[model samples]
Target: MVVERDELLDESCRGAAPLPQEADRVRLDLPRRDDLPDIMYLANNHRIAANLATMPHPFSLEDAKALVQKAEAAHGNSAFFAIRLRTTGRFIGVARYANVEEGMPVHVGYWLGEPFWGQGFATEAVHALVDHAFTHGTMDELTAACRVTNPASRRVLVKSGFQYRDQSMIRSLGAGGSVPIERYNLERAIWKSLRTWGRVAS
Candidate 1:
């Protein structure tokens, strides 16, 4: 089914680009210093860290600060948001659209605090970001990957409509080495179709 339309949709910019889209329960926005405590606490879990690349084990306050700083420092064609609940204003996770270097497809990535797992928050937040990337941003396609073992992350991607492409080895910084991964992609055309169908179905 099409995801429910958010009240934030009416508040969206009519211009070429819009962001910080919201749903009934959560909204996506850039990481902030005030989010440091929440980011540190929720992100310090072994399960969360184990599934992510570059998430420091025993994730520290400094690490949280650096992430916020980095998000603040990033200029254009890149975004990182701290996902928070509207009801409680609780910081629960992060979502990003970035190209770590030139000449790379803007891949999507995200992680949520364990408590928020199985609640559809990751998929909702990701749908917002994906819509922004395809509708507002100028890119042909977006790419994503999940460790072969991470069925959960893979499900998030599939739920967001990504198509599986291939398998390869990638570094899992938290795991401290290379591991198998399943690559996925969603092109502009595919996203357009889904969006159109969503409007029609709704």
Candidate 2:
């Protein structure tokens, strides 16, 4: 049975009390107007923007606002979440299973502040999204990609049970040029099997 988009998240995503959904270290919440400064501060780095496909360098408050608007307009066909630390409630980055291709929707993407890098936040957030997508939502597969040069992100995708799919050149609006990326895919069955093996061990 295909679950409707609105029902993609509910009590099942949390528990009997229906608290905000969180993984081991962070919770995936909606981006808020109050988060503008945090988004601007974290997303303005050249290092961070270079790794992402669409994040523009020197990100501004206006960019964050436009993003917030886009998120608000999406009708739940995708899950766009602001990745926040579970303990501190600090906004570290963003993660989601949106921006899917028209023919096949359900692609995953994420980013974290440079300070939050190397702490496994990206992997943790991704694992949570993958689990939620299979449990509370309906999707057969999820796709992801990273610039071939971005080892850190590629590692996260592999750790999240995604397999190498292909390599292609895609234009990066932020980069103002085309970049090559290694494509990856994670089938729900593969993700589930990994869970059984504790491959997704936190």
Candidate 3:
């Protein structure tokens, strides 16, 4: 079922008061008007643009605005968050869960600005989002995909507990070329087991 914004907010806020403290690492709050410029700059960088499917080669303010609007319009079945450093409040990247098909699985994707690529922030942010999805939503599994050549992204997904599934050739919507992509997934049961294993190991 498609989740509406009001419903998501209501559900997200239920039983828990909104925290007043600044987010020490990552926050999933709604994107704001001021974030457009930075979002475009980071998203359009050559390295990041090459990794993503839909990011334009030269991302413009218009592209950022359009993305923000689409993100806002999308409710139940998908949600997007602007990744920012808590202290600086600068846009580092974007992460999202979408294509939540019933009886199937929900998919997630994300990118980090080149400057933030090696910081482990992507893994942390994705882990939090995965926790939120499994705890708050009904999906039984989560999946993600990345360009086959991008080992950095693959490492992040592995650190977040996703297992490599298989590879497929898909048309790149951004680069306008057919590219091979590797898929990965983690079922809720497996995720739970892995967490337990980690606790025991520690």
Model 2, which residues run further than 4 Å from truth? 1-19, 73-76, 200-202
Q: Cα miss at 129, model 3 (Å)? A: 1.3
Residue 138's lDDT within candidate 3 is 66
**Sorted on lDDT, highest at the top, how do the candidates line up?**
1, 2, 3
As a whole number from 0 to 100, the lDDT of residue 5 in candidate 1 is: 10
Task: Evaluate model 2: give its lDDT.
Answer: 0.71
Please give the distance, in angstroms, between residue 87's alpha carbon in candidate 2 and its true position after superposition: 0.9
Task: Identify the leading candidate in terms of TM-score.
Answer: 1
Please report, as a residue range, the 10-residue window in candidate 3 with the lowest summed lDDT. Answer: 1-10
lDDT, residue 34, candidate 2? 88
- For all candidates in order, the CA lDDT equals 0.71, 0.71, 0.65
| Alpha carbon lDDT at 179, candidate 1 | 71
Stretches of candidate 3 above 4 Å error? 1-24, 100-103, 198-202
- Scored by Cα lDDT, where does model 1 land? 0.71
- Pitting candidate 1 against candidate 3, the one with the higher lDDT is 1
Q: After superposition on all CA atoms, what RMSD does each candidate show versus the true structure?
A: 7.2, 6.3, 6.0
Please state the error at residue 48 of candidate 1 in Å.
1.4
Displacement of residue 106 (Cα, Å) in model 3 is 1.0
